[model samples]
Target: MSISERISALVGPASFVVAGGLSVAVAIFAAITIERRTIEDVETVLAADGIDWVLVSANGLQVFLDGTAPNEVARFRAQTGASAIIDPDRVINRLDVAAADTAAPPRFSLDLLRNGDGIQLIGLIPGPGGDEAFAIAEAIADIAGEAEVVNMIESAELAAPETWDAALAYGLRALETLPRSKVTVFADRVEVEAVGETREQRAEFIAQLQQDQPEGVEVVLDISAPRPVITPFTLRFVRDAEGGRFETCTADTAPARDRIVAAGLAAGATGVIPCTIGLGVPSPSWGEAVETALEALARLGQGTVTFSDADVTLIAAQGTAQVDFDTVVGELDADLPDVFSLQAILPEPETLASTGPARFTATFDAEDGARLRGRLPPGSIGQSVQTYASALFGADATDIATREVADLPQGWSVRVMAGLTALSELNDGQLVVEPDLLRLTGNTGDTELVSRLTRLLTEELGPGENYDLDVRYVEALDPVASQPTPEQCESRIRAIQEETKITFDPGSTEINDTAGEVLDAIAEVLPDCLHVRMEIGGHTDAQGGEGMNLNLSQRRADAVLNGLLARGVLVTNLTAQGYGESQPIASNDDEDGREQNRRIEFRLLASAEVAAAAGDIDDQPRTRGGILAQGEIADWPFEIRPLPRPINPDGE
Candidate 1:
């Protein structure tokens, strides 16, 4: 303020007088310069540049460029031209260009996929006028959850059709009906892919989708429903001090599965759940079989029934009474349909044997109602075993078939006592053990006994112990083993052959129809004799040359073997040989004697295990009764007859 006031006072009147004089002088000079420049080039420059839109005027030392230029460039040129005629700094230019007259092309598309989790959207769409696109996206985000939305749509410049809103609403409604689906929407068409849990659901989804399609729009739909697959239908249940529990459970149908679960509940099994339903079941009876098996298993109190299709395995708890085990196994075997196969295991003392070198044995008879023959350690240990068996089997029934032994491994007494206790539980079966392993074989329907004993042994014996289980759990032991191991098998076969000779056709190897039927009896015994081998030897009278007779005898023997095989006999242990006329049982001089000499005989051969089970017969070589032999045939199971005289080749 001070500086400005001082300067104003100093130059106020003098500056006014000097400015007026200078203005007059400048004005006079500018008028003269304008007059000369205007006349020289201003009008001539406008005509030469064709710049009619521009006008120029002079005012002393400043130049004014007026009028509208055609464009910015024209305006700039006008300014430069005026500046060229006068001073550059004194010129000013003004201009305005026209507004643009075009807009961009259109793009529109949208896709949506929805599942149990949520929904996703993708592709282009017309931009909603006034932020409607944002509002729509926000609405979808709210419905499907923001995390699930995938908005990849690009709005088109063209306005959306009047029906676009209606189509979007229809598609979304259709999507609601199909949680698992993918939907695509075009201006006039809706395409969908969907899944349903069952046929009805799939049908309903498709119907709803088609009905909701926008008016005058095409609807494309793909829907499917499929059942699940269970790799191996499996089930395992057991009971112990902790009660019952299931390792795994599965079923093919609802009803059977329900029954299995119900049985488990009845037995107090924990963690029950519905079995998965599928089409991969072995048969319609699959459910019933499993359910019935479970019930049987439950009745036994402890056991595991593992079923994969029709192959069923039952493992009974140790010490299960032999009668009960046999009854159950036999009953199940008879009751179960032909489609199923049953295998039962009863593990006893060996189940709890010491890992080191040792020997032990135990016996039980549910039928005789007692525990019998067994081997135990000496002194207090042996007394303890005897005492334990007496308690479990009752003193009267406990016929202790035992002897004292020394050098038993540690824990031998405990294992022996445990073994006896386990034996007491069986109906009837004996167990033997050595440094190698222990084995239990008996009959019982009781599942609980096996399950309990199995658990007990696994816990006490350690995992390394071995078991050679021969226990069977059916209504009966073995029908074949039960009826006649000696008579019905080998003895019966020989009896048939003796009562009725199996004759052949002259010198031919063919057996007579009557002979074939007799051989069928021998076939029946072959399987039971899995323990032994049978030899069918053929003989011939001295009517022909030795070579021919020998050949004939061999052929007849071969015929017998083949006939046995044809009748379903397992001939694995059978052989055929020809003695020809060499080993004659009767004089070859007479027809009657010759006929007797030309006969077929059955002989027994014993394998190692069979020899052990067969007693004295293993050491003795024996031939069928009334035939040539080194020793008499033991009263074993096989039975066969001599072949009658064959009709002459000339058809006598």
Candidate 2:
């Protein structure tokens, strides 16, 4: 039981035991040495300043610090920081310091409130640095979740003035100065209310106020006041210069208006109103008044003078003085003798002084009575009077010539006729007048006879001086010849050789006629009928280009139609068409065949329906005797029956 015995028992097999113990001690030491070597091999990663250690439990590793780092980079370093000491089989990533909060700076709120309500902004914003503001707001909303922004900022200054009383005082002063209007002011805002009866005055007042105001005082204008519309007064006069009573019309009753103003002007007028002054004093005549005025005005070389509402006034400047008839007559004589007549009324000697100017009043009549009646040459007097009288009276003149002749010429008798016989006949059986005959009749009779005739006619008639004559015939003539009947148009269609030396052109239907006899004949016959529809049909020779030949034939037909039209035939009645070589009447291979094929022919269009019906009949043949027909029957050969079987030969 001693140490050695234990070591041996534990070492009695001591020699073997001692060797086993040494081996076991050596194995333990080697294990500790390997662990220490691994510890020394590990890197002491001292991170850059401001960095911290991160213990990661996930992989059992300690990570050192650095300035700033992303979360993912820090985490990876924590997992592998003590890589040399860690067992290869174990993971250590659980402990990592969260990355420093490197997010952007916090945003400011731009939420705006207006009138106790949130305002949503739309459209392009207007403000200084507005784009930057919008960008910031948008970024905040994106980062901190969507939040509405309401803009409450106002850029404009208030238009209201400081004190209401001050504004009212300003308005009162404005109104005082603009007496034509009422002025209203709210704050610095001004409005004009017009009291005048015109929009022009209201506009003028507002414009004046704007011009007088100084800067820095903000003004808003409300021009909503009712505007006064002023209409001008008018006056009209009718029938004032037609030898009728003077009439006046007034549009408005206001004495301050132009209608009344014009009337006032007339009352004090010094110039001529050119009013009518009647002749035959004591009992004036309208015709005489018109004539006298016109003559007097004409002699003065003045234009027509007329009285209007402005020329006559109810207001009296001189207390309604009576017109001085003598002075009016003298004035007419001096200024317008051609347009006026002056007649003096012979007053009884006892009443002469009392009559005043009434004894000689100016008269006026129509121009004919003044200048054309007795003033014309005596032979022309009757016609002149009649023409003017008819124009004035709108009636025909009667045969006062016989009644007015002082003495009839020997063997010269006057006769009167009426109705349509006075008119001559035209070729169309229409009646017309011979101008020379009418002129001769219109200038009828001797000079003295005409003068007497006119006076008598005018006395019989009323005041008018116009008339139509019933023609009286002194001689008779034979009746006119009758018109010829319209014969049916006829023209010779000559053999082609007769009219032209040249032959038809090759491949064409055009014929050349040196004499042009056929064309002349056609021209002579064409005018007889009311209308003639001529059909010119052309055929072409079968030499070349069927289409070209057909077209050429058509051109030839059209040439004929053009020729007829040029000769004055109506184009509506003519038609030209070509049939080409398809309608050849003779063989097309020979010259003679081609000549026949190239013929041009004419046909009267008897009726449009006949041509239409011919087109409706299809070229195909109808079945007969149950046989199927082919080819055009028009080209079928005629068959001659053989001589009757010779029964007579055996009998002979």
Candidate 3:
């Protein structure tokens, strides 16, 4: 073979080999590029969909996803999201879903706070029953009409424990009864905190809760009733021929009570005289003031001492030597605390009247009520006398048919008021007020009445003033026999009204003459119920303008009060309020309902409110015998004060 021919053959073969090698290199480069692009695309898709937990890798056209996903849902989501950027067949899911966590169930509890502002519920409740968790809130809203319900509760998708329902129910019941309270409920326990208006109410609340406590659940109840506030704290002490006693005594603290009681005992007060320890002392020197007053009374030998907050009143017995009264009163006035003002009275002997020494008399019995047949100075004083007597006894229980005498003594009103006040201490009593003397004969359930009466008379009349007491202590004549509970008094009044309505003239406040008998019956009941404070509510149909109806109701209520006053009922503790159509028990849509709506009702005042009102009434200063001076007792210097000096023990 020639060289050219060999070269030609070699070239053809070599070319074929080179060309094949080039083709192989290109294919290898293209495969590497395709793998890189595929991996980049898969990663971009997974990253865009927040599937970072999934690790992405691709071999040629096949994509693999691997990583621990938080949950099956998350894993599935990542797979679906990644597949959207590529063919589903090309995507391989090697991602492992995290093992299902063994989580503990959530603890559940509920707290309920109820007050004047309404009810609030907070805490977690077992669920899917979200609506059921609000059942308590809904129930309170329904019962308390327009009461706000604040719900900050969350419900878990879990079943409530078996004990949860019972505990919750019990807590809800407690909440319903306790207006001012907090109730916490758990599966195994219920805690209730409440405040009551009085100790009795607190006891009732505890008893009710304990009685109705749920079985198999622990219950914790905390109910509190605070001490009542005393206004114009009163202390009355007397030492006479019968020895000494307290009619009413109040102290600010236990130590103060002890001090006051000891001083009273030292001054001749006998028996276990109870001194009320309560709030509201005019000054920290209350004990000192009382002690000084008692000392003065002791020095005077026979007298009464009264403390109305910072004011002190001392009355010397009429027979006390002028020098003795002057010395004691002057010393007491000077020695008393600065906060106290003293009024020392030395009564003058009364002149005899042609008509039995210008007498005033009051008689009381449980069955027949009270009768006031007395001579009062002609004027509004007569009306005042009736009103005063009624306040102490009860309007319905008293009858006043007194003739006004023109010439009653100067201190006659004081004597009358003092006698009536003392008589009220007895269950059944008769008091006679003469110009120069006061005589009381009564049966009392209170063993301490005679002593108290003796003290009151001495204080109001004068130390050593002529007064006689034939009062007897009889269990049957206890005040409880005459004085009914507030509820019972209201019930008795209701029964009387139910039997015969207290009718008035059509569209007028004038009570019909026929209602006189009803008024009289109510008056009889009032005397026995004098201690109870009450409201006489007047209501009218919604036929007239709102303002007119209100005015009409007020007038009617006032008329009723005036009628009771005329019947000799005490109106001090009784108040008249006109509601108009504001608080109607029956509908005004029909005649019968309207008639029912236009009726009078008797309601009991809360004990606290009654105390407040009573205090206001009793706060008025009673300058009976005479007001020796006002302001600081020490200001009245002995040199200037007009008190008689004694000539000698034998010579006046």
Candidate 4:
């Protein structure tokens, strides 16, 4: 082809090539657009069904699901369902439904006021369904794109009571008020505005209102009137000091008030305040008088005078005169010669009764009178002598003495006889006359008579040189004999056994049946007593280990205790003790000796009454032989043979 023809032809072929390229480009664009549209449609459908997904890729009319659906089955159904509208071969299921679900944004519902990007929710969720609100909000944000949530869901709380009774019973207590008939409650802003009389009633209303308020709600009380004051009580007594007619004081204050006034001071108090003086009756002067008389009697080396009821009355008599001429005359006879005379002119009975005074005149022979006058001092004459005589004759006077005369011995003898007669008269016809017997015999120069009289008098009188001469009396002692009653014998046996450390068998633990026979004998003798406490002790020898022996002893003791219990002995009254090698009555060196040492002892634990019933028998044996001697055993009226050992091992 020529240059021009060639250029045109090349242009034509180039144009055709360019057109084919344009067509191919347009077709590819249309396919891409269709796939994209299909994916958008599938997503829309999923969104309406509360499902979410992602468009992974699009190949011609085919589509792939990349995001999660509500469930695995739902995801498969979504993919397959989308393929039905598109092409399955182009759809790649590389999406992990579980992973996608974990990564997916939560769905929510929003009944909100959205201004641009802000959201404000308002609605009741019923029954504290706050979790539902959060879920709905999140879901709405996920579906409609992210947004801010101004959550206004309230916490669940109980409804408030509208009535007073229901409110009062709602766990709220009034300060110091009880619910009453007229109480009422009105709640405003979770507060009580009370309108009522009676402070207690108002308080109840306020409390009931407060009771109905929810937590975090402020309560305000608007009471119309002031609450009544609860005043404390004052204990008032009816007293003159309080301008009352009746006089009164605290009962306990009487003692202190009286004490203050009794100290010789006017207590500062008004009204009739009763007084109690603690002054007691004076001690008897009779005790001092008796003590003085006892001292005087002691000085006289005579028998003591004990004042009985009868003696006290007689001595205390106001106008009574006691003619103690025996004491007076005995004193005179002791000081004077063998012969003396006493002219006792006691005051007349009527005069003594009126004046309560005593007068006595003792006369002596001329020589005796001279001796008496010589013994008197120069100023002791007439009135002085008479005063001395009056003192000797006074009611309180016990004795008197006069000098004896050596000259005119015959008159002295006569005076001595008169003194004896006077002594007999004062003695109330009960004079001992022992000293007189000695004096008379001494003057006669009869050694035998003096000795005999002295011995006789000393034997009859006690360790005294004088006698009371009040009256002669003889007393015969009546011995008390107590026979053993059954109760008494039982008590004695129990006491003896307890004190003596007596006991019974070990392992076999029972009191020997023979012991029962002994007890039966005792019971036969004495029958009234009933209750008894017996202590059975088990002792072991030193042949075994101390711990083992101790346990063995205890078991043995328990065995005996059980035996006693089986025998109808009260469990409370029976006590068992284990003394492992502690108490040994015999040597523990040899087998036989050890056997003897391993023994049980029964002891009677007697009470005081039972011990008292044991009588006067000496519980201690005279000697060790007495305890071990066969004669002593034979002397027991009842024979006690040893009980037979049980045959079977378990019978114990």
Best by TM-score: 3
The lDDT values for all models are 0.63, 0.34, 0.74, 0.37
Error of 1 at 272 (Å): 4.2
Quick one: ranking by lDDT, best first?
Answer: 3, 1, 4, 2
- Sorted on TM-score, best first, the list reads 3, 1, 2, 4
- Quote the RMSD, in angstroms, for model 2: 38.7
TM-score of every model versus the real structure: 0.26, 0.23, 0.41, 0.19
What is the lDDT for 382 in model 1? Answer: 80
Q: Of the pair 1 and 2, which is ahead by TM-score?
A: 1
User: Better model by lDDT, 1 or 2?
Assistant: 1
lDDT string, candidate 1, 479-513, tens digits: 42244443245566677778987678787889788
**Tens-digit per-residue lDDT, 1-652, candidate 3:** 9999999988999998999999999998998898788777777777877877777777777888889999999888888887787899998999887888677777789999999987898989886767456554554554355688888888988987767766776676677668899999898899999999985678667755664355678999999887667665667776888888776787888788899999999999888877767788899989989988998899889877777767788877867889888888888889998988888878775444333647888898867888999688888887798889888788888899888888787888878888888878777889898866688888878765664665566567754355666777787665454456566888899999999877677788887877788898899898887766676777788897766776777678788989999988888777776656665668899999988888777765432222222222232222210111111111111111111111221232
Tens-digit per-residue lDDT, 1-652, candidate 2: 7888676565457687798999999988886675554433433332322224542222123322232334676656544555535654453334434557755322221221112122232222222445333432432232222334443332212222234323332333343334333344443344544443344455544554453242333444433334221111112121212222112112222222333224323333222232211112121122233334434333332122221111211111112123443454466545432333333221123344433321101111222121111111234433454454344323332212212232222211110111012111101111111211111122211212222222232233211212123222112221111211111331333333245422354544444564244555565555553233445666677787756666676677777767667777666645676555656678987888877777666544322112322332232112110010110111101110111111111221
Query: In model 4, which regions exceed 4 Å deviation?
Result: 1-287, 292-312, 315-507, 515-536, 541-549, 555-575, 581-590, 601-652
Clashes of each: 55, 48, 14, 21
- Candidate with the greatest lDDT versus the true structure: 3
